[model samples]
Target: MLAQILPWYAHAAQRTAAAPAQALTAPARMGWSTHVGFGPGAEILGRDLRGKRLLELGCGPGHNAAHLAKHHQAQVTGVDLVGLQVRRARSHYGHIDGANFAVGHALHHLQATEQTFDAIYSVFGAVGLVAPELLLAAIARRLNPGGVLAFSVPHPARAGRHPSTDDHARESHVTVSDLIRLPLARWEFDAHRWGAHLSRTGLRITSTVDLRHPRLDPWPTTLLITARTR
Candidate 1:
């Protein structure tokens, strides 16, 4: 696995230097495959969020927030690290009541927020952007007592599936492929690892599902995990 991703990680470093990180990440909406990946998990998450507070950290463009608002009728707040992405989210979802967007770092803001959420959902957004411990602590701080948090992330064991069809052994060798690049990303936590972090933070893992299947992945992506705060 390491062999497969070495080139890709090398490539990602160069790309990270070239383009703004936010620009490098495409808007995750607007594709058929995306519907399958996020739609199913969102549906499950939405069910838990009915009449509840839903916080979507690292929301790319507020698409999922819109779903929670329209379908679940939950008070939703979507946050992103990049200002541009947050701007996009606000525009895309301006009309959805109980749905709002902000640009903020997840772990950082939690240290200050007096607000606690009913449920938290992150669809490949903030899960891999920081250290797992920091994120887990942040979740514990921001999530209401007994609140559940769910996320979809690249299954870490499958991290090294890089293709030779790309540049390698050079400074400019970043591959955007999820399998190779995500493992070498600035921050990445597989669902299991994140769950471990949750445990340390006083949250109990209630249930989990491997989102890796023919329907949800070119890489390993898992689904809703309902964890209760202790």
Candidate 2:
């Protein structure tokens, strides 16, 4: 979270989109400076992903897909809009046996895959700026009728701290600094909206949890959804 206060978190989105990750080499992308969360907690869920054909939407550098193939027995593929990120993921990770990463626009690209995956997942930053309806529709088409799906979405409480006004309108202040460092474009869903998409797609919610930050205390800001295709 130091990224937020330091003014980098809010600008990360801009930096990535502008430079298109062209500035960061494969090693640089996987460097010690990287701060995304894809560890033990993610591993636990991944264990359930074994033997499944898993699709990772907006998988930044394929860390989760690497974890899935190496530790969970899943055949994993990562897709992202950024060519450099996809390139870096592949170069740094190699042909991880059962894994691969590709350049993709989650909405249109996924629909063209035509193969139904056993499961689909997105980490905290997977959603990006893709329209919600487009994402769900693609998921509906790509997931086997009874396949599983899961996502880690940010909670609305994180939109910004709210201030009470006893008798007047209050302004909500959002900082570019806050938005950029956090990579928020893909982080725009809540429990209610999650339910809406799943229900329409014939997916059922099976469980939920408040994810603990890897380096800090638990953030209600991080919410996980476990669902199954119906």
Candidate 2 Cα misplacement greater than 4 A, ranges = 1-48, 159-187, 212-215
CA error at residue 46 for candidate 2, angstroms: 6.7
lDDT of 2 by residue, 17-94 (tens): 554332222221111112343322444243476677988887766677777776666788888766666765676565
Residues forming the 10-long window of minimal summed lDDT in candidate 1: 163-172
Model 2 residue 24 lDDT score: 21
Which of the numbered candidates is closest to the native, going by highest lDDT?
1
Per-residue lDDT tens digits of candidate 1, residues 1-230? Answer: 35433443454354445545331222333211224434354544534567798888777667778767766678888887666666666666776778888777777666667888988777765655456677777887787777777766544444454222221221222345455533334334444555666889898777766545575456554444557788
Candidate 2 global Cα RMSD: 7.8
